[model samples]
Target: MQHLSRRQFAKAAFWLPTLALAGPAWAQTGDDPVEFVESQYNNIYIYKRGTQVSMTFGHNKRLYTESVMDTTDTKALPVEYTKFMTAAVAYTKKQDSILQIGLGGGRTSWYLHVHLPDAAIDVAEIDPVVIDLAKKYFAVKEEKNFAPVAMDGRLFLLRNPAKRYDLICIDAYRGPFVPFHLLTKEFYVKVAEHLTEGGIVAQNVEPSTMVFNAAVATMKSVFRQVDFFPAAGNVVLVAYNDAERLSDAELLKRAEALQAKYAFRYPLTDLVKGRREPSNPVKGQILTDDFAPVETLHAIERKNEKWK
Candidate 1:
């Protein structure tokens, strides 16, 4: 028996299917589609083609397409920073139930699982292939407390109501865009209805795109306080339905408290508040299941590539 690296197998498998479609394209078995395997705190799959490279990470027992860098909860707070600690402590200390929409690289969720040993995690993912790859390469199945469901995220939330979550994380997207159904104000309302009082919903969104504004507006329409914070090139949307004030001062205080306990690189003191884009000049439209022009944002992202 020969030991084959996960990348080797994935390249062979992906190329084989692709060649079959193109009527016998390149079939060199040794051709490496994967650029490299990055294993630090988390396992990263870097696949290459011509000039374009795609990065993937395993989370919640699933393989998710990722941006080139580790953008985890950076939008909310740095993974090595105390912002996450403050967010977790602020929202989830009292509840044991957490629901996650997308499992990407398992970075944020993995931290949550490790920190909250007693919490019940429910994950919703639609792609079975991603799940299979994650189990084999990403150590997703090792998360014993996680329960994964193969279904549309919005549909799952609408159908299931057995247990209410204290913290809801929405990070699901289709390629470079989030599903339209998941971006509507009604969707936020449903997420709110499913939460325990004072519960907060945190979402990781790309700020270079209009989807960020749409998501924020939707969250504001439903939640009492909709705030956005920058982490690298992404933004984390934090929405609290209660009248609690997450002012800069309050957030900083919590970040300091968490730093004393976690000791992360670049304390929360380094985080700069992100200003909401001027939606006043540009009329914003509601993203609906019927008419979400998410693909349009891809064009915008391409033009703004220099900004990233």
Candidate 2:
């Protein structure tokens, strides 16, 4: 494991995702039309392009995508980062239960519910409109097995009495920036409490911003092992409860079995191979509840990326 100092990590690393390779027009897999809009802290919208539907924040860019034709969460899997989230399966023998912090289009939660109907799945989405849109347009069914809790991600972790899950995923996005509360070291500590033995917590991180390195560092502070999968404009961090890291061969062995059983479109074999170790961030530089300059970092990253 390469343990670079905080300063070294910041110097060597870039931030997280914009899915630059993924625009409705770029993918050409959709006939995008504005379906619903709610303007607030984040300009949330549900866009429809042919049978393809997506969740967009702030702009027309598809942050979370889905397809009405194939509601299995496969057709809607437009971004590689979303595919990378599923790599958490490599850490477990069975997907007993899952807790997702964000419910963008409800694709991740929906996929688990569909694939593992017998398993319990809970989703924490702060936006009620996003939840409504998930059902109305995105075809995310309201199933008894899948619970959609309208609450903040951090609060859900702190308050929820059910303190264990086989897998946990965090993908909260506020406009183009991440919620500071959700990116803190304290937040990850709460996440760690909920993880069962051999459990995995996978997060979608955008590396095109300054928060990327700090975010990974915060996660590293709590979890014994952290691994990553590089996706288009993003990186998926998979932190494990176990101290020992799984080799690529072992992860692939589990990936192959799960793939055979589920016949997943995004192969776990491919995702498991992109595993990267985490590096430490500088002291006091990592995000915390009291001080997380997420908006500021995002602004800097946007300018640095030359994104208007």
Candidate 3:
């Protein structure tokens, strides 16, 4: 795996996908037609290309892929960030209760539900339309232990004060940006409160945006220890309240054990191997509920990058 610089990430997130879409191979053919389009929280589009089905949020004539799944193989995660997202399991030994903040196509939730049959999984998807499409087109289903709810992620945590999860996965995004409320220090405080002791929270962050550093800072404010796993244009941040940090060797050892036990499609060991130190003296202000300028920061960052 290659480590991308901030600028490289921006290019990959913005330009690479756009360029790919312009190519003949990516042009929408009769076989790759849009399956559904709805307007609720955002303008959502679901399309299929051969065996791959994807969910994209449309904004300003641009489409940002929120989730992708292989129709032929529901268990296969076609997105790179998703594969790394599952590596969150390597940080904790318990999988009794898991909470996912975003449901996208429910690929991550479905994958975890299948792999961890005994674990209880709760998913919070803000858009009810996405949940419906996820079930109809992506094979997301409510089973004995798996449940997907349509509600704001923060609200879900606030509503369930007594519920504590052993692992919390945050991959929530609206188009190219994360909901402002989800990026604040206050929200992370709530997230930390709902975690069981020694529990870990894994978040998928777009390193290209200005919010990236601030999001990291905000999580660090709430979590005692933070680690990074950079994959493609995204960096999965795994944070916990534990005082002692887990070393690379220890993480690798744990990943190896979990890999042997579960036989994951994307080897956990490969994901753990990409773990490295985050940027030093973390640059960016700690985001608070009272002052989390997510959209403004993203706009400014995009403008600055465009000229350079």
Give the best candidate by lDDT: 3
Q: Which residue pairs collide in model 1, if any?
A: 61-140
RMSD of each: 10.3, 8.3, 5.1
lDDT of every predicted structure (CA atoms): 0.56, 0.68, 0.80
Q: Which stretches of candidate 3 lie above 4 Å from their native place?
A: 1-32, 302-308
What lDDT tens digits, residue by residue, belong to model 2 across residues 1-308?
12121122211221111123344553564534466566444555454433345555644343333222233334445555666788887777568788989887776677667767777898998888778877886677777779898888888987985768999999887755677889888888888888887778999877766677678778877887777776656778888867687877888899999888876666778878777643432222577888888777765542122111
TM-score for each model:
0.65, 0.79, 0.88
Q: Comparing candidate 1 with candidate 3, which one achieves the higher lDDT? A: 3
User: Considering TM-score, which of the candidate structures 2 and 3 is the better prediction for this target?
Assistant: 3
Worst ten in a row by lDDT for model 3? 1-10
**Model 3 lDDT per residue over 77-129, tens place:** 76777777898998887889999999989988889899988889999989998
Which structure among the candidates has the greatest TM-score?
3
